[model samples]
Target: MSTDTRAAAPEVRISGIDPHWWRQAAVYQIYPRSFADADGNGIGDLQGIITRVPYLAQLGIDAVWLSPFYPSALADGGYDVDDYRDVDPKIGTLEEFDQMVAALHAEGIRVVVDIVPNHSSDRHEWFRQALAAEPGSPERERYIFRDGTGPEGAEPPTDWTSIFGGPAWTRVPDGQWYLHLFAPEQPDFNWANPEVRADFLKTLRFWSDRGVDGFRIDVAHALTKDLTDPLPSEAELDAIPRDAGQHPIWDRDEVHEIYAEWRRVFDSYDPPRTAVAEAWVERHRRPRYASAEGLGQAFEFDLLTQEFDAAAFKDVVVDSLSLAAESGSSSTWVLSNHDVVRHATRYGLPPLPETVGTTEQDRKQGAAWVLAGAPEDQLDREKGERRARAATLFELALPGSAYLYQGEELGLHEVGDIPDEARQDPTFFRSPGVDKGRDGCRVPLPWSSTGLTFGFGSSSAHLPQPQWFADYAVEAQERVDGSTLEMYRAALHLRRELQTDETLEWIETGRDDVLAFRRPGGWVTVTNFGEDDAALPSGEVLLASSPLVGGRLPGATTVWLRESQS
Candidate 1:
């Protein structure tokens, strides 16, 4: 018989883990628009992403989730799908997709496409026909329709609010209303229709057969929206007594059933795969998505969850991990993604002024965070690096998968501020000042110290790449051993010690500021939030983002530790 160490080896292994990895995966979300720009169409594209795959491979994540590349009208930043089969002209072509998949596979990195099946762009063929067809006809029923749907006059199916801000309903010219939990241009899908299910299943097969490894389904819980009379707000719907949305015909159970079938189908493909859900529902309902045995991984917004003070931190920690364990599920812990501001800026790291700045590309150098003596003029060289490292450590230590957004490894923070004129996000036109939406996080990635507009683009970048990024680009960090780039390498090297193939073994102790758990092969992780140290009883320091283990951590002031099994 094999020894304990050999027996602990996973049956499946990818990059030293399971063949169907992503279990303890450190997934990196790439918002293509913000990642890297290769063609210089004043926008990012597949070539840019391909050039950067090695950078990701070095970061230690098993897979990369590329947010929608399908043809879109740019509604909700590509969340509105116009065509299910092709890449957006704004990005690249089918050949580029093939090349990118090959490059990533060469590096042993799996690729997951963000699928927006819960809704479709109004320009979609089905939606166009639905608009031309009479209400309740086969085409019309492809979307959720009601003769009288709305809150008061502007109400949605429920009291639920839009995350981008405003009521969730749009009045169609037909005098009836259509449900849109997000934007008016995006129409909700009618999961009750078997045809819709078949079409989406084909969508899954379309890409999976074409070499795509897996899917990261968007707004998964929202796909199972309650069609009940109470028409509740999104949160209340989860608490509205399960049987309310449950019928032989509508809601969540069917959604789970769809995923199970999809999972089975993926298993039959060239490379067996898994599904990760963006179950962005209220706290109480997230469990249902993973509880059904349909999805392989689900995401939790808690790492992005913010508040000051230790007790408050404890509550978040306890609740976040508890929910995952309660349902026998594992979660992907995300701090910042394409949808939110970078954690460096989210934690309030201000922009470095231009004075101390280094080169033409290094406009904001050495603008590091300190308690006092704020400067009015531009900096000589700012240092936000420590704070950046702190956030990275916190994310890596938490139980389950750790999702690091692209550019984060380089300690990339929010842009220095782009004018409203250059801003391309719909949130600017739609909500204005009420919410910055996620523009701060979607700035074009910086590639070099030479400043070719965006670091990689030949012409002016499609999006504003931070001037600070060039000197701080991946290439620049690669040369310096102590750079943020190195911190990521060290962190990943340490993280590998924690098995990626095994099912995560989690123990929910108390505390929100502190998240404590043990790995499947007997490694313990203790992560502390700001204001209090995530105290581990005993163990050697396996990995840390900060120079200090107990006090202030690296960049974000976060800590990650591994103790002895005893």
Candidate 2:
């Protein structure tokens, strides 16, 4: 799908994929805070993202998931919204956003943004009005209102903790109690109210009309809270976004009705829009089983948990596919996103840099091994290589859609240094040591090597581009054939070539280390996770880490093979 072809399509609906195109699509998640910064404001913005669209297109991704950019106080890294309709002045103007959208569409790449419906910035007029006790205000009803009279005007209802690791209830500047599941600045919306659902629909329409294809809906499960049943009823929802076990105490029945209504709204449009839920539903739950009738997709969070073991991983995959999908119902993927630590970091890579202190080629070989096998010590350099390779291959090999974090392909490690003064994420400030906060992993992308800015420009990139990663800047990697950037490009381009058509369907070839699957057009992706050449039984290996015998894989590599067409 190229820009010229997409633009020339006959239907005014902007066609290509059924609303579910994202299922087969490989989506790259960008923390705008860490993407390229065009204006050197030491922060990432819509313009900055515009500058990097080509970078993503070249990366061979079908779509990009951007974190929220609504007008905000920058609390919770733009998740707390002051105004849903306008772009944050710090990020860029709405006009720039329009151009970015058109530019993305022109490039044949769809744009999906993070829409936070669960809560809004307390600074928003609605919250302010509520705080002022405005007469007959609709805003007051939008958020949950408890009179503290349940069990004899005493005993605060439930004792669930806020996601930032504090009491979920915050005393409003007014004399009442307001709820903030994440940040004090953010007040959770009362989904129990119809007006909340209606306003949310309006918010969706605003962006869709502005050219956004859809949204990734953040803290999606939290939209529906069990304020009555001791705060929540599920282990997963109780775990918070950063923690594991995302069962849905908050993912309830009415959500299906809301999704169904939204789907009807989408049908009103020509091409039809896509809507993805962030929480998981039971195998027989309405959102997962009856999803086709209402929403386009429901996110599967099994990957975000401690279910990193191979068998557990496989179970999640099988379960996800079996659940919402009968034949063509949409199935979502969850490997990595902005809120979680980069996969490269999570799979137990050394907390610090591994490839350093050695020659680039030597480091490449070491990384290959690390990516291929689980580590004796997750932080060991010997294992980082195999794990990196395996993780990358596995993500690409998944049946449903996939998400790539900004620095993962670069084999980037989690940033360890956080100057106390510079740590902006409320999670750290609010939780203390219970959570280190997401600041390090979400810092600005360094594009230059001259110094700290990673070659993105200067120290003034949109959000403090890390000085450490700056040395591994994009240009530096582009110049080096074996750099992380090139590897990512190769892997991505290879995936594009393998999945030439729409869907990715494959059979498990009965091997743990060797993950073999077939693409829609009879092409198979066979991966070998070892230090020596691994053989493929049926087809000739097309792509390899090092030149393979049958283009076979030696030294932890993935080979694309296509059986002859009948």
Candidate 3:
């Protein structure tokens, strides 16, 4: 396994167990626009997040991963960044950002900011300059600008499809088509340009100098595209085995060299800032992104896509651990994030057929279901919450980092009936309503149940919140016994003590619907996925996702036990 050569931060008192705290840290993700709003402008801001630092501290997370707070027009929910070096005025000024970081640090919670190197807003200064500059100019070279293929340049340069469901190329006023893998307003950067490389290096140092702990690299795999003279057709690209080699626009071999250079910058600091890649590469190739010489960790997202099956979850954990071992780094466990359906809602949905091969496709299917306005009658909220709680405990017991999205602790479900006009995700408009997009999960959080917007802000929330959100609000859950929020607090508090090291050994139960694993320090975690309760191994009960009946773990429940010394 690869080792971190940099010295650990002695001043950091947050989980002094590992010099690289990220390895076992329970990091919470904050989608800024939906987290909290202090300005009472009906939007979440940096000041709003600063106000919630205590809430996070009590949540027992070691770190907070903030989604893009950079300047943006909300073209793509802040992913379409307009500036890399400054904060958006709508949220708060850079000073407020510094204050937010300080507040988090005071609570011993490290901060990880988002870095979108894959693309920039069409309104970004560089893109603006490129639009005004002559063809083949250095300004144009910073992005992928090319001549169209058909007569009078009417057709796009390639038959590439945007991930949002349209032509990937957009024709400029000058008749040249620019490449955008996602939205037309978000143009892909030409990583081959030295200016692009140097600018990102500068952006890294800027944040690192500001005392930010790390970065979450967005769309991390597509930074370096193989821009050959003759690009491969979509059909040709699809036929190639994913593991065979590099593709033209995703997971190219050259991407590692850029990361190696970035590693040097990451290691330059005394304690050395860290980063995790949101890479969606194949399992075998994923280790490269997690390599010690490159990005330190790769998000093991298969867990997020899973349907809470014992065998499937076990397989994911085993493969994730193996990949982390190969990369000499720790895996990251996440059940939900800003880009997908909440696990509480997902657990209630029917499992994808065996024919579905990828997590991306699985997520797309989930989104399509939501867009189709599937009736709430189909959702088993009781079963979903039970399975969600069990899954959270199962994820926490694993031998790696754990990431929790905002509002998950309260067992929030996706709001499927969001009014069409209120929808903001580019996916909805780009897909032309074929996909409802991520607005359901991005709805502003409900802090209290008394107000119309559930105390999100003084005014209405940007997206309409369902009245049922009051049932899951923090205020309501805190007052109730055995609520999802209370259970999460209990589980997280126990996790810090029970999670000892990066080691997990399967304890065969000789049953198909059960999963049992032993961690270091004699800490054991068991989950019952069968239709009926299952007998537990002999151990002292430390924590349980639900109340144990006759010392048995109920179906769709997980428990943690400590083996007593003889």
If both were scored by lDDT, which would come out higher, candidate 1 or candidate 2?
A: 1
**Pick by TM-score: which candidate is best?**
3
In order, the Cα lDDT scores of the candidates are 0.65, 0.63, 0.87
Residue-wise C-alpha lDDT for candidate 3, range 1-566, written one tens digit per residue: 01123322333333443458889999999999999988888789999999889889888998999999988999899999888888888899877887887788888889999999999999899999999999999999999999988799888888888888788999999999999999999999999999999989988987787778889999888899877877777787666665644788777888989999999999997677899999888888899889889988989898887778999998989999999999999989999899888888878877655555555655676667644645567788888889999999999999899999999999999888888899998888978757888999999999998896898888888888999998999999884778999888888889998877799999989889999999999999999987799999998998888889997889999999998878
TM-score for each predicted model, relative to the true structure = 0.78, 0.82, 0.96
State each candidate's clash count: 49, 33, 0
Worst 10 residues of 1 by lDDT: 1-10
Model 2, 424-493: lDDT tens digits are: 8886687554445667568666565666566554555434444556545676677586566776677777
Against the true structure, candidate 1 reaches a TM-score of 0.78
lDDT per residue as tens, model 1, 1-566 = 01112111111223443444665677778888767777777777898898888777877777788998888888788899998877898899777887888788777777889998788998988888888888779998889887654444443445554444566667677766777767888888888788888877777776776667778888776566446665544665535544433632223556777777777777776447677887655466667666536766678766465432345444565686788776666666776687655666545544434343222112111212211123323321333445446556655765567887888887776664677677666655666654344566777777677766636677776566656677777678886866887888878767777664434344454655555556555566544544444445455666565555544332225444555655
- Which residue runs of candidate 2 sit more than 4 Å off their true CA positions? 1-20, 134-138, 149-156, 226-249, 280-290, 304-310, 350-378, 461-467, 500-512, 529-533, 545-556, 564-566
